[model samples]
Structures are given as C-alpha cells and as structure tokens.
Target: MAHQTPDLIVSRRYLRLDCLCLLLLMLSACSSSDQIEQQSRTVASASQTVLMALDAWAAGAAPTAYTVDTLQSIGKTLADTGAQIRSAETSEPTEQASLTKAVNDLSVAVTRAEAGLQADDRLKVQDAQQDLRLASRALATAYAKYFAPKP
Candidate 1:
C-alpha cells in the first residue's frame, strides 16, 4: 500500500474543503439565455467524457497517468463552465442559485475522482464515479428546461 504521508493528507483535506465552496457564476433570464443554454450543454458533453475516461481507467484499459491527465483536462472544462456561469447576468436569480449548487456538486465530484486516483484507492474511485453520475443527473434534471433543443 502507498504511504499516506502528511502532505498527502493535507492536500486531500484542502482539495475537499475547496470543493465545498465551489459556486457557479453568470446567468441572465433574458439576453444571456443562449449563453446559459450553451454552458449547460457543454457541461453535459464534458461530463460524459470524464465518466468514460474514469471507466477506462477502472477497467485497466488506461494507465493511471493517462487517466489522471484526462480527468484534469475535463476538470478544466468544469472550471470554465463554472466561471462562465459566475460571470453571466441572471434574470432568474433563483435559478442561478440552483445551478450554482448543481455545478458545485459536479466540481466536487471531479475533484473527488482525481483524489481517489492520487490515493490509489479503487474503492474511493468507484465512490467518486457514483458521485459523478448522480451529480451529472442532478445538473441535467435541475436545468434541462433551459437548454435549447438539438437539431
């Protein structure tokens, strides 16, 4: 088993604490409607990529470093989406607040998945995968009405 050094413990705690504080940014009920729609779609698409990457790693189809890189790459997508959410104007403050929570939940799930890999804990990684699945569903269910239909 890998050693749980103090640095590892501290990093884990800090990452989790940061996760709890995650929040989404911008949304406007009127002019920014298109932007919100795009952001939600992006989140959904990026989510699938991350989940698939994690699954590949778990199934031994991918190496740890590759999986970690993929997770980090997708994690940046979440971060960008969150930033866009934070910066946009909102005609629906209540809806924005709800989206913020959903986005934050997804952000946390991503971090947890990466953490699990760092710790070399398959159980934790599995748990993170479940978290990602639930979080993704929550994000879609809570805000699907706002997205534009695909052609």
Candidate 2:
C-alpha cells in the first residue's frame, strides 16, 4: 500500500473536523427543542395542580395549611420552569421570547395565589386561578407554534 502524503493527512483531518462540527450542531438543536418541550409540560402540570388545589380550597375540602403548601410547591416548580425558559437555547428567537413572557406571567399568578391563600381571601384566590389558566394557555400556544408541523 502506498503511504499517504502530508497534504492528504491534513485533508483527512479537516474532513473529520467538519463531520464533528456538524454532529455537534445537530445535537445542540435537538437539545434546545427537547428542553423547550420538557419545560412547557412541566409548567402545564404545575398549573393544573395549583388550579385543582385552589378549587378544593374554595370548596372547603382542603385546609388552608395544605392549600398553602400546595401553592408553595407549585410556585417552586414554576420558578424552575421560568429558569429553564430563560436559559433554553431555542432555534427560534421569537419562540424563546414568547416562552419567557408566558413563564413570567404564570409566576406572577402563582405569587398572587400564594398571597391570597395566606390572607384567606377566596375572591383573590379565584381570580388567581383565572390568571394562571390564561398563562398556561399562553405557554401552550407558544409551544405549539414552535413545534407545529409544516403544511
């Protein structure tokens, strides 16, 4: 077999480098989209949990202490979700921006819910549930827009 020249070896190295870069780019894209999907689902689940807790509290089926605990737990989850939304490396900048807003809105609603629960104001708590539901819908809309199939 003939030995390869220096030029050939350099060319081979360049080809390998290009392949590695391409692989890394593809992985980065996949990771960004996956992170967005996961964060959206987590926020939706948290919203539903908090909304159910609010309903139970309104009906007097849930004690104030337990309802407060539930709100706190959901608040923590929303905080984490907000962080994920801010840091996610989305392929689409618009999608990223929309997600950030949605999470922020939801976080605010959670804070209001917690406050209302502590003050024993059922009206405020009910209003918070509506706010949270809307925020959750906004998140779902953004997520769907990002991942919707092309016609």
Candidate 3:
C-alpha cells in the first residue's frame, strides 16, 4: 500500500475549496435569474390586465363616465397605485400591498367609468375616456419598471 504525502492532502483541500466556491457562484447566478424572470412575468400579467380593461371600454361594455368626485378619486387612486407598483422594484417590502391596491383601484375605476354609458353625457364620457387612458399609461409605466432589462 502506498502512503499519501502531506502535500497531496493539502492540494486536495484546495481543490475542495475551489469546488465549493464554484457551487456558491452558481447558486447566486440562478437566484438572480429567477428574480428577473419573476419580474418579467409580473409585468406581462399587469399588461394583460390593462389590455382587458381597455378592450371592455372600447366595446362599450362598461360605463361611459362616473360622477365627477368618483372619477377624480379613482384616478388619484390609480395614479398612486401605479407609483407603488413601480416602487416595488426597489423597495424592501416588495410592494405587494401596493400592487394589490393598484388592481383594486383599477377595478373600481372601470366600474365607475362604465356606469355613465346610458346617461348620454358625451363630455363626461370623454373625460372618463381620458382618465382610463391615463390609468392604462400608468399601468404600462409600472410594467416597464419590472420588465425592462437592466441597462
């Protein structure tokens, strides 16, 4: 039987250390990729939601306008909700609550906007249309924040 020298044992230890380092690096890379993919999926889902709302509006399936105060309130809510979604990208809490708020606010806004369809208030309808467009744009912005690849 041949006896192994001390140098050989030290060399084996070094090799083990290198392998451990490589494994850690690979794990880090995988985690980063998962984060990016998750962000992309979130953005895509949000886009789909916005598109559905817009389609419903275009098809005359929803209200034409809302009471002035309701419109303003919903618009403001949508705006704030959008900001929160974007902020989630960098915020420590991940802004889950904010994203939920955005979805709920958008739902309410759609309801209010669609409620005015039978009133025949063209000007108010137009205003609601503008607000809806603004809300969609805000959603797009928030989506972009998550989906856009790092520069």
Compose the digit string of candidate 3's lDDT tens values, residues 1-151: 2888999989999999999998987776566445644643554354345445545655676543433344444445545544544444342233344344445545555555545544555555556556555555554555455445655
Model 2 misplaced stretches (Cα beyond 4 Å):
1-5
> Considering summed lDDT, which 10 consecutive residues are worst modelled in model 2?
142-151
Tens digits of per-residue lDDT for model 2, 1-151:
3899999999999999999999999999898888888888898888889888988988989999999998888889889888987888766888788888998899899899999999988899889989999998998998888788746
Better of 1 and 2 by TM-score: 2
Local error of candidate 1 at residue 139 (angstroms): 0.6
- Total backbone collisions for each predicted model: 12, 0, 5
Clashes of 3: 5
lDDT of each: 0.80, 0.88, 0.52
> Model 3, residue 2: what's the lDDT?
81
Better TM-score candidate (1, 3): 1
Residue ranges of candidate 1 with Cα displaced over 4 Å: 1-31, 145-151
Q: Whole-model lDDT for model 1 versus the true structure? A: 0.80
TM-score (C-alpha) between model 1 and the true structure: 0.74
| Whole-model lDDT, model 3 | 0.52
Given candidate 2, what's the lDDT at residue 131? 95
